[model samples]
Every structure is written in C-alpha cells, then in structure tokens.
Target: MLQQRFFSATSSASKYYKITLRRSPIGLSKDHRASAQTLGLFKLHQTSYQPANASTAGTILKLKELLQVENVDSIPTKEQLQANKPDRGYQVIGKKI
Candidate 1:
C-alpha cells in the first residue's frame, strides 16, 4: 500500500509546456500568423500553457523561431502570479481620530 501511494503521488505531478511569444508575427507569412493565433499567442511576450504532448510539440515547431518554450512541472495560479508583482509606491496621509 505504501508503494502504491508513492507511485500515485509521483504520477500525479503534471507536466506543462510554457510557451511564450518572443517576437512579433507582423509582416510574417500568413501561415505563421495563423499558427501563432491558433496557439493562443497573439501579442509579444504573451504566455500560454499546454499539456506536454506530441501534437502541441508539432504546432510549436511550426513557429519555433518566434517563441520561447519551457517544460514546467507546475503552473502558477493567478493569485500566486499577482502576489509576485512589485508594489507601487504610495503617497497618502491619514489622520487618526
């Protein structure tokens, strides 16, 4: 039972492909633009995550020159990402009653 639990825990770890657009697709061939849109990346520096699979790999290869790809084991949550942002400086004065 212990061995089975360990195996399941290890298998539950997911693998995702973190794909980021590194360059503009403007003025490129129509096919390239279509491929980028199809992959859910339309603007420079935008990121999309997809499962690590053969079909996604093929699509990525089609527009590899304009993208940055990395294999990540986990995806960060929206709140987690927001928490990492730099805080804005504040200018405020308050009077206590």
Candidate 2:
C-alpha cells in the first residue's frame, strides 16, 4: 500500500516546460510571431514556463526554430523569477516629497 501511494504521488506531480527565446522573429510570418507572443516570449533570452500538454506542445513545435526548450520538474513563480534576477547596480537617488 505504501509503495502504491508513493508511485501515485509521483505520477500526480505536474511537468513543466522551460522555453527560452533564442532567436529573433524578424522576417517571420505574422502568425508565427503571434504564436510566440502568445507563449509569453517577448524578448530574446526571456524564459517562460508552460505545462506539458498538447496545446503548449503545438505552440512550441510551431516556434521550435526560434526557441530552446527543456523539460523542468517544476515551474517558478513570478516572485521566484524576480528574486532570481540580479540586483541593479544603481538605485534611484531622488524622489518628489
């Protein structure tokens, strides 16, 4: 019973895809660019997480030539992404009181 429960728990965990835009969309068709935009990739080297499913798979396949994809065990939340970013070297020095 314990073994069965463990297997089920692992199986129920969701899988994610890490997609990074590696190429520019210049000269590409409007539809292809739109598809990439729909996938939340707006800039070069930007990464987005999406579930491993048919629709997402189709989108990735459509833009495969312009993107790099990897299977990730989990997705990072927005806060996590922000936290992972490096701090800017300069801070705002003045503000209206």
TM-score of each: 0.73, 0.67
Clashing pairs in 1: none
lDDT per model vs. reference: 0.88, 0.90
Which lDDT tens digits does candidate 1 get at residues 1-97?
A: 9978765646545599899999999989899899999889988999999898778899899989899999888899999899999878976688678
Q: What number of backbone clashes does candidate 1 have, counting pairs of residues 3 or more apart or in separate chains?
A: 0
Q: What is the alpha-carbon lDDT for the whole of candidate 2?
A: 0.90
Runs of candidate 1 with Cα error greater than 4 angstroms are 1-14, 90-97
Candidate 2: TM-score? 0.67
What C-alpha root-mean-square deviation, in Å, does candidate 1 show against the real structure? 7.3
Clashes of each: 0, 0
lDDT of 2 by residue, 1-97 (tens): 9988665656555598899999999899999999999999999999898998889999999999999999888987789889989998988889989
